[model samples]
Target: MFKYDLKKTLSEKVFIFWSMIFPLALMSCFYWAFGGIYDIENSIDTRSVGVIYESDNEFATYFGDVLEQIASEEDAILSVSEVTDKAELYGLLEQSKIDGVYLVKEDSIEVLMNPKYSATDSMILKAFGNFYVREYDMIEDAVTSGNIGAVATILDGMNEDADYMSKEEGIFAQAPNPYLWYFYSTLVMGILFQAMSGIYIVEQLQADLGVRKVAMRTSVSPVPKSRLIVSVYLSRLLVALGISAVTIILMNRLFKVPVGNRLPQLILLVVAANMFAISMGEMFGLFFKGSMSSRSGKGTGVIMASVFLSGEMIATLPGVFERYAPIVNDINPATVLNFALYRLVYYEDLTTFYIEIAKIVLVTVVFLVIATMKLRRQKYASL
Candidate 1:
């Protein structure tokens, strides 16, 4: 029975498209649009900066020393150049020989950049200047008030490389990749569409739904409805998982999307997600009053809405929901699956992953129990 059902499901062209081809096409489009941006974001090139001192004051000397110290670091992103002539520094910037220049006066510092300087480099330089100014203000205030202890404390903090925050062992090793969010959310959207198979299961087994003759024959067959439902579910689930595996392989190999190294956990997540999606479809099939195609259409609407809320379209929507309406994320199957996949790939939060799996299991059981009861009570007088 499972083999027969698997063959029948595989024969459905629409199912194949939604479960496989469409997602691949969408992912390819995303890669083409954002691949260059991702590369640029990850590549950090060192910038050459020139420093000119107008007066050898205490603040000017300290700021120059700080810049020298930063430039000396092995992985420094800035190369410091000291020039005595302001005209020479300006000439260098104008000719694109240097990215930016700093002017240190008696009590203030100024940053000058070429018009064509990289925006990222400009932002970094500005941030460094702002931080130095803030620290200088703190020291100035302490000295003016004759707070020797505060001045010493601030100086000690500036001199020491103290790490206030430590990274967890299993946290995302590199900077967060914004593009991965879209890809993973799209994958979850594909998994959610497997609910169509579940809907088809209901259409085949429900006596009064879908094709009357087929449903009638299936309902009255010698096979127990429980066995029939399980067989159909297993078959559809196998197909869904197979398609998902292919999608994941293509995403990693063809598109160069890294899905992380935790293969077992990833497999677990997709399996649970597939089951939850299919079971949700089963419930929709049983509760909604319509033909199979009508139910499938409604199911698609619901899935699309869930995917939208899960950040398939707007990457910030999930964060917004987390702040304002967290329950939406908790209950929405698509969001749950997406969160699980993301955390599994990027974080050591196994507790949250298991919790999401539990939710998927609980929902699947509820859907299956409700579907079973409804199908059991369904009787035909003259079918």
Candidate 2:
């Protein structure tokens, strides 16, 4: 009987589609759209900069060689464009042809930039200017002190400081990438897809509205309804966990997502998240089962609603709720699960990780118990 139930459940087209193909297909689309972005973001090395000189000025002429040297290398810090006219330089800055403008002076170099177009490149240009000024001051000091030997040591120390500044912060805790939010949302959406199996389970019951020939047979059989429900739960649980595992593997290997060093913890969170999704789905399924209406449309709506609240649909939805109706984040299963996984894989905060895990487990237990009670209470006038 168990084998028959398992086979029938797995054989359903909807089951196969939702449990496996949909996730892979969606992930493929995600990979195609966003896979190259990380590399592109990381490869940016040179910012376009325009250097305008006062014609016939010896100081500007002297700085031309410095700018050329800085920009001439294969992997240069700045791609320099020498502008002879102030009007032309302003045009380039306005059109964003140059990230920033450098005005060469006899004693100091001035930077001109349009705040509207300037971004990180502007900051890079400013840092470069700061370094040049520091080096100039050091050279002047060394010349005045008549200590050419100490100049080398001071420059070496400055170089060391620059090297330290260039080094990235700890592997995971560095600057946050906005692109990762979409990937994180995709994973959560895929896991939430597991709810489809739960809806299918509910639809199979004789008490529900759908064609229930199997449910009728099971009703008359000696095997209890509670036992059948448990089997359905287990089967879907395993399937959901399997799908999540596959998703994680593809995300890391195919998409080249940096999952970091928390593989074991990530795996545990995946399983726990799947459990929460399955049980939550069952809770909704059983509720809608009692209503005996079409479960698919309603189930899909529930799933979308969960994702929306979790900020899968809108990135700021959760944040908005957090500020105003903060408890919604705590109550929303999808938000809780997504946050738990995010914390586990990205933040690696043990305290929040364990807290989120406990919340999921508690919610799963509550939903499963409610669903079991609903199933146990079923009474058929005629089967």
Candidate 3:
């Protein structure tokens, strides 16, 4: 089977390239360029803070706009909110809506409310505050000291840079970076397992070798047909895990991503998910005959359904997404793995984790049962 699958197989080499080489190459690049740059964090003495403006001072408005832009970027996350009045802002603070606030005045800005927010972020926020002061002072110096009168001389003679306030504050905390694994579990895990599982199913259904082995070997060998199918299915499950394990290691070792505590559990989730997917593939395969033509349609359907229903793609889809979201997300094992990993790593909240684990197991059982039914009862021409 290995030699035959390797020889005429159009996709085998493609999968090998994607599973091994692509991840190693991509991750090595990230490790060198990004690893050190991200390590620099502000100290506890200074705070990086987000500023919000209600009526909007000139300095306040400018900083607020910059904050919004920076927040959208990867390096910084500025949580800023604008309201009509102080009353509204205060209400938000009381409700723990905003992490911290910067109230901009005519001369200076103030950080009001939450102190638990990262000290570095708060310092950066307050650095914006000092920036306003320095700019105002520079303009004041030019006007009052008559530097503006001799502006050309000052510009020509001054060789030193601006003496801006130093950035010396950072929130000192330990938060695991879950972005890498979450990205892996959500996107890569889903597509790879699905395609492999579905393709394996297709292979089994169409191959005369599989039929001959099963029909001839199982019936007389004292092994139950159910056990025979389970054994075959288990082999495929191990193969999927083998691929996933290598991919995960390459990603982690090269990129040095913090995948979180109980990494073994996450691997368990990966194994169980691939098994479920293989079982699903087996069930789907029963629909196709020896020609293997039907596998494409089924494969396409599975891919579409998995990606579409995955909450990661569209994100929001009204009530069906939020209310029945877990169910919808369950339609894609990748989503299950992602949400589970998110909980395990970042959220550290266990309620949702247990539920997702249960759902994964349930889905696996259903698919396995369906595959067994198809294998035992379905009528088909010999391959």
Candidate 4:
């Protein structure tokens, strides 16, 4: 029965199409739309700056050294180039070869920028100049007074400040692209296709339409109803999970969705999610079997509503609802999946990951139990 059921599940063309092929196609579309966004956002860092120094001036040389030091640092904010001639420097600035030009004065540095370019890069240059000018008097005073200790202390403090600012930990952690929310939300919605397959699992067992002809035949067999139901569940579970694995692999490998280092944990989350969706599908089928005239229609509607609320369709909906009404995320399967994946990629905290897994398991168990009760109470009219 297990072997036959498995074969039957795998052989269904519509099942394979929706479960596997459709997601692969959808993933391609998602990549096309969102792939370039990361590059655009990352362009904000490491702007090019042209530096023309007054070599004889001590503060200018000092300011140039500061630029070199900053430019050499890891994940540098500026790329510095020295221009010996003012015409060449301004020419580079005009051509947009550099973001801004730094003119060194005795006490301070001046920023030269073209109005056509974005002001952010020039603003950064100006800020750096302002900060250095603000501190130059102290350095001059310390050197003239022969306060060698104070000079060392100030240089050391500046180096320490630079190091601290360079480290991108805590608040400066790299953010996932906003468009990724749509990809993740869509992935979760695609995974919910399991629930659609799940609805059929319940429908096939219940005495129903032409699709249930096999159920009618299986009922007359000597096999226990419990065993038959278990076989169906196991067969569909394997199919659903197999399709999910394919979807995830395509997303990570082909689409480059950045599933991260927690590959095994991600597979586990997929497993738990499949279980929840399948169980929910079964519960829907059993609960509404005779009650609804069009069980599939209503089931599909519910799944669509779940997907919409999960923010699969609208990217901001998830953040908006999550921020305004926290309770919605608690019940929405799509939201739970979104949060779990987000935690895995961004935080990589196992405690929260496992908690989400547990929640999915809990949801699965609840629906499974309810469906089991309904199936047990079900008595068929002889065909």
State which candidate has the highest lDDT: 1
For candidate 2, the per-residue lDDT at 171 reads 18
Candidate models: Cα lDDT each: 0.77, 0.66, 0.52, 0.70
lDDT of 3 by residue, 192-240 (tens): 4345454555355433425335444434555455655655565556556
lDDT of 4 by residue, 52-149 (tens): 77555778877777778888989888888666688998998899888888887666677888776542344456656766775576778999999999
| Lowest lDDT block of 10, candidate 3 | 169-178
Residue-level error in angstroms, candidate 3, position 115: 16
User: TM-score ranking from best to worst?
Assistant: 1, 4, 2, 3
> Which is superior by TM-score, 1 or 2?
1
* Candidate 1 local lDDT, 167-261, one digit each (tens): 12221222224577678888888899999988888888877776656877877788888888888889999999999999999988877776667
After superposing candidate 3, which stretches have Cα over 4 Å from the reference? 1-182, 185-195, 198-202, 205-224, 288-290, 308-320, 323-327, 377-383
> Which residue segments of model 2 deviate by more than 4 Å?
36-176, 206-210, 289-293, 381-383
List the candidate 4 regions with Cα displacement exceeding 4 Å.
38-176, 208-211, 289-293, 381-383
| Better model by TM-score: candidate 1 vs candidate 4 | 1
- Choose the strongest candidate by TM-score: 1
**All candidates in order of lDDT, best leading:** 1, 4, 2, 3
The TM-scores of all predictions, comma-separated, are 0.66, 0.61, 0.52, 0.64
